[model samples]
Target: MHPITTVHYLALSAALLLIGTVGVLTRRNIVIILMSIELILNAVNINLITFSRIWHNMDGQIFAIFVITDAVAEAAVGLGILIALFRNKETVLADEIDLLKW
Candidate 1:
């Protein structure tokens, strides 16, 4: 088998990005949208790590670590908000939880 290359990594990242975008755009569930956002973040991490490997540098890895941290924080906060919304509205659907609408 051919050794894995940056091109392969890029293809994988592209696929993830596509799927995440579709998920976010088409799904109405708030939880699904959050998951799709995480997928997009993961795709970014893959690209950063792949480039770091190609360049033989630590910068990409460092940035990837930061991205991971950010993703974690975002997930925590998002889930907290989702839980609150569910408790108040009794629904997780994006269209149903229109708290912002006046």
Candidate 2:
């Protein structure tokens, strides 16, 4: 064993990001897509924090903090949009929300 390291964290993060990307690309449910995006952001934070701990760099933590802020904002705005769409259409499915593609 090469001893668990920051690379392990990075690999996990990459796997999460890949899963999120696939979910976003393949899912028809709007809520699930949004959740996958959140997962991707969370994976990024994990990588940042892991690097910060491994390298003893404060900047990585700062970047992770900023990523958290962005994730929060994305959640707020995305959910707001989802709610508005749901109110208007009564469905949260991405396929049903399309207004321009006939």
Query: What is the TM-score of each predicted model, taking all chains together?
Result: 0.93, 0.90
Q: What TM-score does structure 1 among the candidates reach?
A: 0.93
Stretches of model 1 off by over 4 angstroms after superposition: 99-102
The list of candidate 2 runs beyond 4 A from truth reads none
Which lDDT tens digits does candidate 2 get at residues 6-93? 7788999999999999999999998899999988998999888998898898998999999999999998999999898889889988
36 in model 2: Cα distance from truth in Å?
Answer: 0.2
Please report the candidate that would top TM-score against the real structure. 1
Model 1, residue pairs in steric clash = none
